[model samples]
Target: MSLQQQFEQAVTDSKALPERPDNMTLLKIYALYKQGASGDVTGERPGMMDFVARAKFDAWAELKGTAQETAMQSYIDLINSLKG
Candidate 1:
C-alpha cells in the first residue's frame, strides 16, 4: 500500500487499539499525527497552566523539522507497535 494509505489506516486503527497507551505514548502519537498531517508546529504554545495542551504542543514542536512523510511513517510504526 502507499504511505498515505497506510497512514490513514493507522489513524483508524489507533482509535481501536486493544488498550490505551500511556500518557507519554499518547503524546507521541498526537505529535506524530499532527506533524504528519499538518507539518510543523504552528501558533502559540499553550500556557503553563494548561498542562495537557502545553505538553502536546511541546511534543509537536519537538518534531518541528521532521518531514511529513517521515512523521507519517513514524506514526504508522508507532500505531502498529501499539496494536501488537
Candidate 2:
C-alpha cells in the first residue's frame, strides 16, 4: 500500500487501540500525527497555565524539521505497535 494510505489507516487504527498508551507514548503519537498531517508545529505555544496544550505543543515542537513522510511512517509504526 502507499505510504499515505498506510498513514491514513493508522490514523483510523489509533482510535481503536486495545489499550490506551501511556502519557509519553500518547505525546509521541500526537506529535507524530501532527507532524505527518500538518508538517512542523505552528502558532503560539500555549501558556503555562494550559498544561495539557503546552505539553502537546512542546511535544510537537520537538519534532521540528522532521520530514512529513518520515513523520507519517513513524506515526504508522507507532500505531501498529500499539495495536499489538
Per-residue lDDT of candidate 1, residues 3-75 (tens digit) = 9999999999999999999999999999999999999999998888999999999999999999999999999
lDDT of 2 by residue, 1-84 (tens): 999999999999999999999999999999999999999999999998999999999999999999999999999999998999
The residue pairs that clash in candidate 2, if any, are none
- State residue 63's C-alpha deviation in candidate 2, in Å: 0.4
Model 1 segments more than 4 A misplaced: none
- At residue 14, candidate 1 shows an lDDT of 100
User: Model 2, residue 72: displacement in angstroms?
Assistant: 0.4
> How many steric clashes does model 1 contain?
0
Model number with the top lDDT = 1
lDDT of each: 0.99, 0.98
